[model samples]
Each structure stands twice: as C-alpha cells, then as structure tokens.
Target: MSPQPQAAVGAPLSRVDGRLKVTGKALYAAEHDVKGALHAVIVDASVGRGRIASIDTRAALAQPGVLKVIHHGNAPKLPYRDNPASNNPPDGRRLRVFQDDQVLFHGQPVAVVVATTLEAAQHGASLVKVEYDERKPSTDLEKAKADKPTTYARGNAEAGLRNAPVRMDLTYRTARNHHNAMELHATIARWDGNKLTVWDKTQWVVGTQTELSTVFGVPMDSVRVISPFVGGGFGSGLRCWPHVVVAALVARELKRPVKLVLNRRQQYFGTGFRPAYEYRLRLGSDRRGRLAAMVQELDAETSSYEKFTENVMYAGQMMYSMPNVSQAYRTVPLDVNTPIYMRGPGFATASYVIESAMDELAAKLGIDPIELRRRNEPSEDESTNLPFSTRRLRECYTTGAREFGWNQRRAKPRSRREGDWLIGMGMAAGVYDTARMPAQAHVRLDADGTAVVDAAASDMGPGTYTSQTQVAADALGLTMRTVAFRLGDSLFPPTPPHGGSMTMASVGSAVLDGCNRVRQQAIKLAVEDRESPLYGAEARDVIVRGGRLHLNSEPARGETYQRLLTRNKRSHLEALGSFAGPAAKERHSFYAYNATFAEVAVDAALGLVRIRRVLGVYDAGRIISPKLADSQAIGGMVGGIGHALLEHTVTDHRDGRIVNANLADYLVPVNADVPDLKAIYLDGEDPNADPLGVKGLAELVMIGVAPAIANAVFNATGRRVRELPITAEALL
Candidate 1:
C-alpha cells in the first residue's frame, strides 16, 4: 500500500505539517487564543527545604494590570482526591500544590501572579517576595546511606570469581540530563461553569486530565486537554508536572482564561529531568571469554516527597546468560524536584557501566568485543524465564559488523591512526523491553471517498500523525491524500503517554483496529447494496485497493467506495477502535535490540575527543515507515552524541540549584558535532507482539550509543572512561 513518490507508509516522505511548522502557523500551547485571557507567572521558592513563613504580594498588587497573586495563605483548600488511574503517586497520596506552606525543594512554586499581559505577569511575579525557614539539604549521593539493598543472587559470585581467571571491578558515573525539548512547557486553561478546558503541551492528555481533576476536585469529564503540536519531548513531557496545575489554579482564581508559559530559565526548574546515576560493575569471566558472574551497585536520585523508580536493575539481569548475578539498586532521595522518565532512563545508565566494563574485559583477555558478546548470548530472557517474542540482537550485530566494516578494527590499542588523529572503531549491544498499553482511535469514512482518523495521541516530533495516517491508508484501502489524521484533543479517543517509544505500537494498533472495522463495515454495505461489483461475493473475499472494493479474483469487476456509499444512501460511516492489552504477556518476552558502532578520534597529547561517525543497526521489528524510522534513528544518535560528549545538567550542591539551566551553558550535539550518522532497521516483524508487528525504535537508537563512543575512546587512547561524556578533561 505504498504511494508512488508519496508512498504513505515506509516512504522517506517529510512531515505532512512541515509547511505549517516552517511557516510558524502551528500553534503551540501558549500560541492558542483564549477569549479575555490573562497571563500568569510562577514565583519560585528561595530555599531548598523548609516551611514558607510569609508571602508578601503588596508590591505585586500595586503594579499596573496585576489582578491577583495566589499563594497558600489566600488559596482555597481544595480536595486532593485519590486517583489510581495513573500508576503514579504511590499510596494514592500526592503533592498538594498551593494547599500547604511546606517547601520541599528549592524553586518550588510558592505563588502565581496573574495580570493582563505576559510582561505584567512577569513584573508582578518579580515583585512577589517569599520568605522561608531554610533547612540543610542532602544533595550528595555518595555520602548518603541506604536502608536495604535489593539483592538478587543466582549463584555465589565469590565462588565464581575465585574459580574464573579474569575479572574487572569498574565504576561509571552519568551526569544528570534535561530533556530540553525545544518548546518550553506551557499550559492555557479556561474555566466556564465548573468545566475546565486546557491547551497543554503534554505527552499524555488523559494523565493530565486525571491529575487536574484530582487537584481541582472536579470530575474527569469536566476537564478536556488539547495539545496538537509538540516540538520535542524525549521524555520530559511524559508526566504532567506541577506547573500545568498552577496554570489551572491561577485561571480559576482570576476567573479568566490564563496562559502560563514556562520561561526558558524556568524549564530547568519547571520540568522533570533524568537524575544523575552512579553505577559500579564487577564482571567475572572465564579465561575463554564466557561470563561467570556479574554484580552491580546502582544509586540514582529521586525527590523526597515521592518514590520514583527506574528499572536500573533490568539490564544486568537479562542482557547476558550468567548464572550468578547480584544487583543492589538504591534510590537516594534528594532535595531536588522529582525526576521523570528520560530517553533510555535506567537502561541508558546501566549500559554505560555494563558495556564499558565488558570492553575492559575484552581488552584484558585480548578478545574481539563482538566475539566476546556472541560467546555470552542468552537463549532467553534470564530474569523472566520466557522465550523472546523477537530477539534478533545477534542478527543486528552480524549485519552491523559487515556494514560497519567492524572486522577492520585492530586489536591492539592505538593500532589504527592517520597522522596525528587516532581513529578507532568500537561497537556495543543495547537492549530495551518492548511495552504495550491500551489505546483508542476514531476513524471516519466519508461518502466522497475521503477518511479522517482522530485520536488524542500526540506527534511529538516522532511523526505520529504521518505514520498513523499511513497505517490507516493501508488498512482502509485509500490513497494517502484522501485520509487526514488529527490528534491532540481530549474530545478524540483516549491514548496512552507518548514516551518510551510506545506510541507507534500502542496507537498504531488502535488505528489498525479502527480502520479494519470501518473497512469491514464498508464491505458489508457494498455486498448488500447490489450496486457494488460482485455484489453477492462474501465479505471475506472482498479486497480493497486504490480506494476501490471488489472481488480479489476479479479486479475489473469493482466499484468505488464512494459509489457504493452514495447508492446505499449513507452519508458517512464512523468506527471506534480500542486495542486492549494482552492478558497473558508472560507467555512470550518482548524486547527491542540494537547494535551501535562508533568511530572516534582522540588526541594523544591534548586528549580532545571527537566522534568521527556512528551507525546504529536496530532490530526494532517491522519499521512502519522507513523514512520516519530513519528520522527517529538519526534523532536518537544525535541525542546519544550529546550524552557521550556534551549534554550535562550541573547542579550547585550547596543550594540544590541547577547552575547552567540555559542551553548556552549546557551543550547538546549540533550539526557540526555530529558529522555522519546513520541507522538501519532489520526487515522483519513479530505478530506475537502486537497487531502492528512493530517494536519501538526511538529509545533503542540511544541505548548503546554512549558505550560505543566510550569503547572507541578506549581503543584510540588505551583509556577506558567508564564515566559518560568521555570529555576532554576526562581524557586529559
């Protein structure tokens, strides 16, 4: 069902909304118009942790256009109900913003100032002074002690290490990183007769609606969220943060629609970020290169108010076939704001240590890195004891090695070089367990032979709108131009959060179901109409192609869907499709695999590190759109380059404040930094996983990228940098 030149699916076509985005006509959250709308700015707490003594708003109220400043003192004590719909907020109790004076962390929202204009709101917020009783904050993870270590042991690590010949005890440190999606987080809220409507930049509209309902003590139905276009999310937009709630609260207090856009500086404090992680790996292997045992100690940061868990212990448990393995994963609650899921999350942190440590062992044993991994490949997921739904990691490595010319890599460190630049190639394997969630979509078939698919699913730069349109076109037997896909409105069908690379699998499945139903209904109508060709043919034998339905055996004897609809006196047909999750997922394991190869240059004396090229081979299973899949791949590689050589979120431990909150100070990979990057998805699909037979590609592209770069650095300079960013200072 590929359209020529514009082959709807698997074609390298650009975004359908590229024109609107480039022309600046795409309205983001703050860009939406609200009648008689006021602007709101948040006032942040000055102390790390303590109680708010007083909030003075006299000067702010005296300012021109300043309507009101809402703080805990004057704010209403609303009912914060328990909502288990979201798998968040353990024990069903959550943070009640503006309902109490307890300041949990620095930069906590203390008050919100509303005014006629954005500038007036900013000026008013600057005038609102907040005094707090400060307390000593614990921002250091090393100094903190854990109450208990979640231990897992399959065999005695001590015994294995004693009997085995080779072992390496290495530790890695990954700095905190912010998602830094180009568009700042913003929300526009309006309340009319106890009903709330918001245009918010969110990854999950249903989650936001539920959270807002809980906070405002309103019914979920009374709230509707809209987010049509998003610049980028990575993972920052996955959760509904407190700032969104503040926008609604301010709008309700002012009794006028209010738009609250987080300033550039506010993005650092306003949104969630990937927490810093410290991982220590002890790998024990035989002299022949077979893994004997693995032990990992992982510590990550979280907020004091809530328990945030990232499955850091996942990779060590299932990546290899080691019988003896033990992992102690602990979360150190810090005084900083709560952290949210980021790209690769726990797996990214663990891979840095595990992969780097494996490279070190390869160096010590004088074995090829690829050969070593192949020697230890697991037949099944060790942790779950279930067969993989689709595990082509081995194939990924084989194809990647051939395509990347991995065999050309030399064994001896510093063996490959040209003049002063030391060029070395390295590769690492990465894993991510594929996930599925329930989703719903509504598809409409028009009498004019055009179709429209509507869902609350968002296209946060991953081409959800375009990709889903392709799926609908193939399923509905229609041309790409005739089908229009619309998203980002709560009035549409419900959808899950767009993070974790699950949108394609989740939403695509829903689209398939909806379109299948619509097509079946059309087929039924055509057979009964007597106007359609081969009218008496069974519905099962009826096949549609190029917007026409007819018998598969006799293509010439067919009629256009438009003709059938018009002759049947039907104006349009609509179908609602919902893909419920599998009840027995344990029957088979599902995971996405990738093999990343990197070429790096390291200066012998200056220790300057530069990535020469990167190629990622993915076993994500049945790429829905090759063009869009490649886009996801390239975007991920760029993010990986940042994680390897640039991106770092620096915090001032003294005050528990982020130091370099702006992009100018905190660096990311630019065009000049990433020279040559490419991605290739293996041509295959697994029906056992889902109806779409598509595993996610977004996160897998970034999984082993840092390790590949790190391994390349080691090969070039003979220095194994377990810590991330493999920066010039670390090399020097």
Candidate 2:
C-alpha cells in the first residue's frame, strides 16, 4: 500500500483544547461540582517516627458544621487487601491509612475532619489535637543504612581499572525534589451502595480504579474513575496516594460524596516526590579518552515501609561503551514518604553522574568534550548485545554542536569573560529506553463525517489530545478538525499509564490500527458495492481523502462517506485497535538519543550562574507534533535549569520534617532564569519501535539537560561542584 500523505503528523498544530482551557470551561478534579458534597481535611502528626499516645477530638466535634472526626482509635477496620499488580512500590506493604497508631513519617495523617463546608473542615481539623511518643527519625540520607545492594557487572572492572593509564574517582549528591504541579492533589469520591465513583487528578484512571477496588475489597467493575483534565503531573500522579483512599473511606462512612483537596503545604507530604541520591563514580580511561572501566555506587532515599527502586544503574551499564563495568545500587530506608518516579526518573539522575564524569575525563585528557563522547560511541548496545533500532546520536551531536556554535567554545576554562561574568559552553549525550506496552484504542466514524477516538491515556501537558487526533485524522483520511480524541476515563479503551514517554509509541500505535481498520471497512463496503464509484477497485489501490474513498489510479472515481453510508443505511463504522508490545526475545535494542548543549555565564565574585542559551537535538524516532515537541523540550530544559541551580527539598534531620514544603520556600526556574532555548528533532522514524514511529520524547528531552548545564558551570568558573542545586557557597 502507498504510504499515507504527511499532512498532520509533522505539522506544527495548536492544541485543540486550548480554547476550552483558556475559557475556564474545562473541568479538573476538584472543580467537579458534586451536590451536597462534604469537605474533608486530614490532621497531620507532629513527629516523624512515633506512636500515637492520645487523641482528643471533643473540641472539633463541638464545632458547628462539623460532620464527623475519625481517627485510628475509632475508625472502622479497612480491608487493605494486597494489590501487587497496582502501581504500589514492590516488596513492602503500602501504608494502611488509619489502621494503626504507628506514625511512619512526619505529617502522617492521624485523623480526618469531615464538615459541611470547607471552612468548617479547616476549623475542625485545627481544633483536633493529637499527642505522640516521638522518636529521633533517620531522615538524613547519608546517615541511614542502605538495604542489600543490587549489583550488575560485565568484565572484571577491578582488573580494567588497575590496567588503565588514567583514572578519577568522584562523588556527587542530588537533593530531593517535589513535583509541585499547578493543580493540587484532589479527589471527589462518592459511594452509591456497592458502587463507587471518583473524580481525581491522576495520570492513570484504570490504575486508580484497580487500586481503589483492591483497597476497599470491591470488584473492579464497581469503581469508576474520571479525570478529564490534569494541570500537570511530571510523575506525581502516577500512583494513587493515601489521601485518595482517605476521601473514599470517609465518603463511604458518611453516605455522602466527599471532596478532599490538599493545600500547597499538605501536597508535600500527600504526594510522592523524587528521592535524594548519593552517587560515587570511578572511571578508568585510556590516554585517548576512551572509557576502559566504570564502577558506580549509588544510594537513594526511600520510605522505611516500601522498597522503591528505579533504573538508576541503567546508564552506567549501557550509556557509553566500556570493556568492563560494575554497579551497586541501594535504597536507604528513612522515615519519609515513599519516592515515586519523577520526570526523567532513573535516566536523568544517572546521566548527570556519567555525563559529568565524561566531561571531567575529557578535561583531564586535554580533549574536546564532544570528541571524547564521539570516541566512545558504540556501534550497538553492548549491554544487551543487540543492534539499536534507531541510533542517530551521531547526527544529533553534529547537528546540535554545529547549530549551537560549538567552534566558538574554547577548550580552556574561563577563557571568555564579559565584565564580571565568565562564559562557557558544554554538551552531553542522553539516552532513554524506548519502551512500548500493550494498549488498545477504539475509533468510531459516524455517518455525519465526524469521528471520535477513545483511549484511557493522559495528556499531562504533552499534547496527547492533539497528537492522537492528528494520528487518527491522518489514518482515517479526514481533516484534523473532523476527528476528536478523548482520554482519562476508565470506560475508554485500556492503555498503559500515561508516563515514561510511552503514550505516543503505545497508545498511538493502537489508535493508528483502529482508525485504519475503520477506514478500511468503509473502503471495503464501497469497493464491493456495484453502485459505488469505487466499485471493482482493489482495496490497496483505493485511498481515502477528506472522507471520500477514491481509486489511487483515478482521482475522480470516488464517493463521500456521507453518500455511501446514507445510501447503504449504515449508521456508523467502528473498530478496536491494539498493539502487541515487544516479543519475549527482542530483535533490537530500542532507545531514544539526545545531544544537549548549554551556554552559561557565571559571576565569579557573586557566585551567581545565569543560563545564556540551551539547544537540544533529539533523535526521538519520529516527530508526532513539532510544536508540542518544542514545548516539551523547552519545558524539560527549564526543569533542568531548576534542578541545576534553583530547586531543592530540604528536610530537617532533627524531626524528619520538610523544612521548605511550600513553593515560596522552595524555588523553581522562572521566566527570568530561562533565556534563549531551542529544540531540533532529527527528521526520521523507527519502524522497529512502534507503529506510530515515535520514540518517547518527554523523558528523553530531560535526561541530559542537567549535566549539560552543570558542565557549563564548571567551564565557566573552573569550579566542579558535585552536588546539585550548586549554591553560591559551593561556587565561592
């Protein structure tokens, strides 16, 4: 069959839901108006690790409009059924809400106050008092003991290190980070007899449904989850948090709908955040700057109750080629909330250590940073011994370097200065696994010439609605406006969680399949009918454009969908699309690659760093939406700027309390911090990755950004600050 014309896929289209959003007509989770819904506020414990000694709720019960005050002392015993298949962390039991007097972390919910109004709920919550037997919590990551180390090794790293000509050992620390999405973590849950309905701000509706069903000991069919809009996730909403269960449990007890919204401060403890990491890296390289061995020791923070682990060792095993590699990754259990996947998750953290180490090695060997990376580039994925599905990193580097004016950068540190500012450029190579999971989508084409495609996916500011609509419109041979995409509902066709940059690769493939089948059904009907203009034409030879089925050989031989369906008395055409994920034994190692460049100016006297410019060249399979891809890339770089110089979540080791839990205390990059930024996608597709030909872009864009900025800082001021959020004190 002839390839579909490139009309919508690569086009820079505006978001279809922009108008609805700007007009404030789009409903988010907490915005849903549930009549007679009561408000619930949780009372947090003062101590981190302790046992509740006494609870006094008499004063709260006396408050007007207060419906009920429930605590562990009086709350009913929940089923708390185990659900390993859910997004819960592995090996450890999830925190059972209001099931015991034990306090695992500071700000743990000790009790809940339900009131007829939000104001009353707040007043009641403040009136309730709780006393605890406090214990000194081990919130400090450095002091906590790490669990059994997970090890990975290739050749003998010790022998390789001993034989190498040059070596360097470095230790780096990254601070904890919060998601801090625009919208609060909110849920409105209502129970009708045995059935439960919830409107939540979440990334995965089906996952939430399954979690809630399992938690309440109810069948999955009895739970319905809806989330039409999300302000932003960045990975915070990936799991169903404890507050969601609290809302549902309270609603079931009161026999009325309950609305619970965490304030900005409560969000810090209510939702998951990126864990702090301590990484020690040792690199052995030849005189030519070729990596001979790499030994990585990693320790990350996690909650005492759950074992939360990410792929932090992945980049060490595969990012750059090395004859010998060894890794040990351990999670240090602390009196804190369980960590969850943040933006780039493991790849972003590991890339910072590896990429920065590579830059250091380049300086030690007196070679250009880009040249050093090029020297160690492997022909295939050495870790898996499989050829890459699409490895255009060389092209990305060349393009990014050229476009970023790499030739202007001097090899020496602090070579260029403007007044008190020293300018420098740095670059890094990034890789993220191209992951695709089984997904299903449903596409329906009505006789009115409009279509709707449904999938249980999420947008989360990545333009899933616009991109999926583009895919469906092109596949069904319709204009972009004629097709509508719907998501974030459990009733829609099931899809993988809208994270890990896999939505386009997985859900989009299913959308393409379904739309094609529906369009093919129409062509089949037209070609088989004797009265149709496309009669007797081969199905492959027939193409649909603007809802008209026409012979490819003869453009004039065609009929509109309205004419054909109206004449045949067919109401609509529908089909279910699906994509089977990777096979048991994969033929290729699929990964998205990026070459990220950054220019920074640092004030030596003041220890202030300013970003001059950033450029990211991506070899991310295919460009689904260029405009949206640009937004994603720019946002990723801005986030990296925050991670490099602005953002940090501070925890007080004395009592295990988050010192800076609000936005005013914790900082992120603002418009002033970001200057000129550009994103370039190498024009290409990887048929081996998925049907949509898109490698994940969201996570890939963020992976190498921090390292690039950090490397630039080193070049600018001749300061190699190993810790993230390189404050002025470290630079000075």
Per-model RMSD to reference = 2.1, 0.9
- The lDDT values for all models are 0.85, 0.91
Colliding pairs, model 1: 3-7
lDDT of 2: 0.91
* Quality of model 1 by C-alpha lDDT: 0.85
Q: Could you give candidate 1's per-residue lDDT for residues 1-732 as a string of tens digits?
A: 222122466666677787889999999988998889999899988777889998889999999999999989988887877767774553213567799999887788999999998899999999998888888777776776543566777778767866778888888899888888899999999999899999999988888888889888998899999999988888888777888988888888778899989988788878888888888888899997899988788888777776677767888999988888888887887787878888887888888788888888888999999999999999988888989888888899999999999888988888878777788888999988787789999999999999999989887898888899898988898887889999998888898888787888889999989998998899888887665675787888787787898777777877888888888888998899888866564688888989999999988778888888899999898888888888888988889889988998877777777789899999998888886888888888979888988888888889999999999988988877777767888877
Task: Indicate the residue-level lDDT of 185 in model 2.
Answer: 93
Best by lDDT: 2
Clashing pairs in model 2?
none
10 residues in a row with least lDDT, candidate 1: 1-10
Model 2, span 218-291: residue lDDT tens: 99889999999999999999999999999999999999999999999988888889899999999999999989
